[model samples]
Target: MLAFPRPASSAFYRPDIDGLRAIAVLSVIAYHIGVPGLPGGFVGVDIFFVLSGFLISGLLRQELLATGSLGFAAFFARRIRRLGPALMLVTLVTLLAGYMVLLPDAANTLGREARAVVTLSANHHFMKHAFDYFNTATDLKPLLHTWSLAVEEQYYLLWPLLMLGAYRAGGGEKALRPTLLAVLLLSFAACLSLSYSDMPKAFYLMPARAWEFAAGGLLAWLPLRHSRSAWHANALAGGGLAILLCSIVLLDEHSMVFPGWVVLLPVCGTLLVLAAGGLDPHHAPGRLLGSRWFTALGLLSYSWYLWHQPLLALGRYYDVGQRDLLRDFLLGGVLALFLAWLTYCLVEQPVRQRRWRCFATDKSTLWAGLAMSVLVWLVASAAMYMPKKYPWPGYQAILQVKQDQAQLPPGCDMPERGVPLSPQASCRIGPAHAPLQLLAWGDSHTDHAMPMYQLLAQAQGVGILRRAYHGCPPLVDAVPVGEGKVRSWCLNHSRAVMAELASLSRSGLHGVLMNVRWNGYTALPVAGSASITGLAQADAQGNVAVAGAMLAGVGQLDRAHSLQVMAASLDRVASQLAALRLKLVLLAPEPEMPLSVPECLARRGAAACHASRADVDRQRAAILPILQQVASRHANVRVWDPIARFCDAQTCYAAAAGVVRYQDQNHLTASMSRTLQADFAPLFSWARQP
Candidate 1:
């Protein structure tokens, strides 16, 4: 085993250590860029963690031993001096970019993300969006990099107290070693466990990250001093460097996690290199790290890290062409280094030398920067509070995102929607005690099809009752797999609705109308998880599990559902209506508008970009089949597809011939659904004639 020896000096800043910094940061930048033979370059941050823990703990330990107490104010002041300026600058840049580039929906998300970044809660923001990544829009927020700063901020808040308590409770410098060792062991155990149980959470947050810092703490507290043989130093340095290289160049996919036990390769490798610091100058790799060039990059590592991500991210965002990705990555890398050199040589050195001393070290200055960050975050959040009103440019691209987010039909989620009031609880859609009772029951898709039903009811002179939820499909015969608990609740609820409908039908209710996202029943496991629900037999990774309920993932990707359950339910409802001699007319699914009515207006007004023909075709095919089937079967059932009114060979406009067609993806905005039905009112008018 090797050990790290600390000399009794607070100012022992080593240039060779800075060279090691070059190794760690370059590895991370390389891995993110997907450079050849460097798939595991991310592990380099682990190496940095170990180095940081050892170095910072070493400084704090020396401070405590000499002064008998930690300078809490001074420590935080130093941190502010080091981090606050750059962070504030970056947040401003991010907010400015968000305002200029993102759509209203996307900008609203950026606003939410800005608060997370300012508050250091970005890890939580991403975790919540994890399950919704496919249909949900991906990150457009520029401040995403602040997740690391949040981790660091959390660490700074809690770590000093822990160290102070350990030192004071031990009563002397001698007790420091044992206390740190114990803490390291315990923290490492927890980190190891989290690496297995909940890797994503562990990887994203700073809790598991504490152990990487602890590893460095352990090295700083080692009992023995450095004593490396020439042969040993060469062999050990070579072996450790090999492991570091392996971690940087090879690890890929989702096999292991960062800040976990697997991170030990780079962490321990960094420690091993530290062990050889007192080695013979003849040792090869030591001389390599000792070189002036590597040390310069190491000294500049902090600036390099700050500059790289945003630069590359902006290029990727714009999809800039530069031959192949390698050429683009290299160009980005060169630009990053130039900016890093500028920041270090110009900003960092000048500040450290007290050239800008007044603002640089002042308490009020940090407070001001923090206040500015808070103000930006709050402004962004207020914008999010009503994001649609903002005149953001890219919103047309994300209107589909709003539509794609139309999971389930309507209602039917956690708290329940469109449920009927208890019989004792009176709620009416129209005037009470009308001459004819009209009951409308189904999903939000039913809500969208409502205006047509309303027209028919009006022409026939009857009242309308509505009951439906977004995700709850109309299943009559069999229980859906996947949603064991949910299926039970929904089945009981649907049974209750049908039973109530039975009473009304028997009571001589004039008509019964129903509608649903029918393809909601046939979701395939592969390409269709977003469109349909409760039926995807397998997931995106080919695992057998139903994904969310949406229109995109309808029917089967593999094994088939005759969907006998849904078909039977429709037949049963139809038979009931026929028996009651109620006028029964089913709407053939209306063709989906390529854009929501609002988005179409924006594009026409030159406020947004239009979607591709491919998007329209994909949506059009989604509901075509069920619409055809409902029209052909029951003689009393009438299907109505308004494709003729809104679509042409060239395109399907969200609004056509002055008719505003949709509120959102499929639900009619209450106003648009009601008003637009006037043109299609004749079909319902004809259907209800006795």
Candidate 2:
């Protein structure tokens, strides 16, 4: 119930719309702060899109009806005044903070993103870099939230031109609705087509998102505000509130394919509320939204949106030791709100309200905005190249961590992205002239353990032919079901590896060493972490097209069935190796850490970089029995568990005795990988036998 002064507004201005803005911004911040039970709070951006379309399109329609033409310069100037100043301030402050505290490489990335922000192309930049909006890694990127702003800016660029064209072609504002309808339908079609097939494209690109704006614009041209019956308006408003609440509660990031048909629920819900005149003082929703506190929050919404993400991301980037998410959220929230209020009073209101002499005229305001943008671009350019020009603090430690990455011989490393795996290809890790004794194969887990395999190969005086794919497990006819190249590559790669094993058995290969990220592939998403599930298929080209719907609603029964399939696949491989008289060593799942060892070591001691043993046990519980059962079925097959080597009674350590053990959350560094020679020696001894 805080009282605030009213700002100047036209007749069309709805205080309830500002209340809606408050809801959108607050929900987004809550989602980013890891707020429980609001996983789909991201739909708040959809709400903003609708609001923008309604407001902007209504203003343009009014201009066209009165003047019989659009004033392009005035429209663009108003846009620059509203959006540019706050963005520039935020980008500048973010750059300074990033340069002060972030790692050199991270600072340089921030600088590049800053430049992209000023140029209003951050969406394209992030899309090119393949930044997954839903990934946990986004928590470290201070400017990742700017992608939505870029989408809005890009929409502004094209939408006005389209409106002008329709006004001139059809004579005044009459043709505006049909034009918006055409855009809405076409953009929605594109959104549906790409949501499952090309998720990143659908998420970051404006063309796929324009339908949201168009939905709002169509509402502007409709006769919603002139409704005579109060009862009818009340019913529509109630229904819309119910729908919005349902959309927010039901949808979550891990499973939902967004911006598709499912998006219609929120968009239409918002339309209903607007159409019912939710700002009318008579209605409950309207009264709640138009109240003093909500409108005040709505007034500060833009600046809050600009401030919150940077504070949250920067806090995470620099945090050390024991982490408390709720404490951090509260601290960051207080700081962001304080800064947002300051910026609203000092920067946003001045530039937007035309209080300054430089902004007194539209033309002058546009020029001043241009000058501010240039300043940001130049400063950001310096930030981008400064790390390369001068050595940063802790340079040597950063270099060492970079060098600690797994060393695969040339032509042997699996592509992290693009380029499907070739089943016919294999890399030798020992001397070229040595006989092939062990075949090392699996996913990236096999790649991480290669240093140990290499030491064993040289000590045994034998060669190991290694084959690995980034995300593919060595399971017959079981392909990961999802978007991207991984699905298309896994099945074909597995078949090729199986064929190569058959050929190698005839060529005197003595043993096969295998390692896969068993928990990653077998476990369902838990604690907001994404997990992979495999679908059964037999296509040679891995062209098995499984719909996302086929994988949805997978219960415990489905998981049990999947585990049975995985065990059968492992048994089939073991049977093939047993018949060939070759020993099969199945490596158990490596202990995965919650934090990067090198990142943790850079600021804290080794003691703080360990994972809880109970957590690891829970993660691996489902997959271990299947591995053991498969090994028990064949005399030549043996399962080697690394839990004893990597863990004590209570914790699994990420580093030991001054040496970092892991490169990232799940992959072992080469330095640590080489230290496991003893564990691998027995396998090499068996491989070298007869």
Candidate 3:
């Protein structure tokens, strides 16, 4: 291993280091903007981590060697000055923009994120929320990038103190090197172990990331020999750059095993560049990095990093047209540069120069900075609460609709899926003294119709025993499976529902209502069959023979064999219910909206909320025939199709008669479900006859 030389008494400015910063910041920006050929540009953060460790450790080591002590207060004050001003300005600006443009839920989330960012706990907050850094939803969060800043700030708090202790111990630098090396090894081991099991910890937590920083600190302490060979210096620097380029081009957000062993590519590459540049600044690589443009970009990198994300997030929030994506990217890039330059000149430079000398003292600046952050937090909090205090008419209408929809009968809010519910635990909706006239069972689709079921039960003076397990179908034999594993919770819930239905039938249950998102099971690739994508492509091209052959080769009747199995299981369940003298009603799947109803209404109005008939037909085609087939096979089974109530020949209305029909894409809102109570009059009349 090549040993890095210890720093001299005076610290010299390295333009090449700034040039590396330029590369780091630009790569991050490019990735955020969805630039092609730079899928792993996010590794720039790892580069920043290494650079921070080296630079900050070198400064601390120099202080210790010169004064034989470390000044904690002074060091902390310097950090606050260096990082606080631009961060505060950017956060405040971003919050203000969010308040002006974002919807209520999004604005509230932004406020919470802003508070987390100011406290330097954004990483923990994101980890607690299970916010995957690579998820598409992360693009909506303006402050998501600040998680790295929080990690660096947290490191700043503890590292100096640890360095102070190490320097005070016997054999100063000698003891410190070994200690840091141990920490580096332990942290790297923990990262490797945790990345597989708890990726969020590996991604966000300080301990898992400490090794990179330690590598830099160790490099700072190692002795370097100045080599006269130009080829050697160029080779080291060029190799490092090649590794960085390869990482940027090859790896992507979808690579699950990231920030684990894979992180070494960028980390080691950064180390090589730092070491080579330090040993021989006159090398070709050093000259390229120290060029005027690279150094200028390096100077503005910090502010640019802060400015770019919010602009991009806000642009995305507005739902920029797909055709305009490239234009938007270029505009955002330009805006980011303009804002970064302004912030660097106006906020960062002024603060560092101490132009406001009255509050220039270390203690005063720290307190003042804290106060500014607190003020920004208060403003954000106030803005987040604005929707509640002064609600928009459309928003208020939606809220009232949701409120009415939530007026479900007793025990409607059952424990969420995956939680164990007793086989005896049931929600009774309707007249209290009435015997149970109906039993409803399935997944979230059944739960979504609770309001309508309650309405029907009350009108007929009957009771419903509602038992639902979201994500689990009503079929006993067909367990919900994903990624080639049977979901134990779903399987357990299905068995429990079966047991409950049998008990209910003995206690005078008149009928069983089966509702589920049938398409979900049907869409899955058949076990031991061709992949869904391959089957879909073949089917789309109208190659019936090829598709048939593929299915036959797998010993499957059709691509939707899973759905067939589920239908068969339902038939068995219905027969058993009929033996107990109970009727069976299989509610046909509703026409699913293409987008969120409320969001569409709020953004594009009711006219645009209707889904085209072709889209609705496409969604219903596969599942409808299977439901009809099941209904025909059993004498007691009745299929209830509600498509005509919300859809016509032209389009499926997401909002009908001035009321939103869907809570989301697939589920009926409570209010809309209640409106369909009249459609179930026949079922209620049947119950009342008895």
Best by lDDT: 2
TM-score, each model?
0.64, 0.85, 0.80
Model 1: residues >4 Å from true position, as ranges?
A: 1-11, 30-45, 129-139, 192-199, 223-227, 253-283, 286-297, 307-339, 359-690
**How far off is residue 11 in model 1, in Å?**
7.4
RMSD of each: 8.6, 4.2, 8.1
Worst 10 residues of 1 by lDDT: 1-10
Q: Rank the candidates by TM-score, best first.
A: 2, 3, 1
lDDT digits (tens) for residues 1-690 of candidate 2: 122434457675677788788878877887888777888788888888998998888888888888878788888889888888888899999988877767677788898899888888999998766335776667777888899999998998998899889888987667888899999999998888878667677888999999999999888887645556677777877888778777777888666677667888778878878877733435667777778888878888888888988888888877732235776577456778778788888887888778987777889988988898899999998888786666466656755775686667666645544234433234788876888878888888898889888887777678888788876778766665532223555666677677777877888888888998865555345322343454444454555544543342244214565566577778887887788788888888888887666767776767777888998898788888888888788888888887888888899998877667887667888888888889778766876575
Give the per-residue lDDT of model 1 (tens digit) for 3-105: 1212123345555577688898888777555577877876767777788788878888889988989988777766666666555555556556656554566
TM-score of 3: 0.80
Model 2 lowest lDDT segment of ten: 548-557
| Error at 41, model 2, angstroms | 2.3
lDDT of 2 at 554: 49
- Counting only residues 3 or more apart in sequence or on different chains, how many pairs clash (N, Cα, C under 3 Å) in candidate 3? 2
- TM-score of decoy 2: 0.85
- Candidate 3: where are CA atoms >4 Å away? 1-11, 320-324, 392-405, 408-428, 432-447, 465-589, 601-609, 613-641, 644-650, 656-659, 680-690
Against the unseen true structure, what C-alpha lDDT does each candidate score?
0.57, 0.76, 0.73
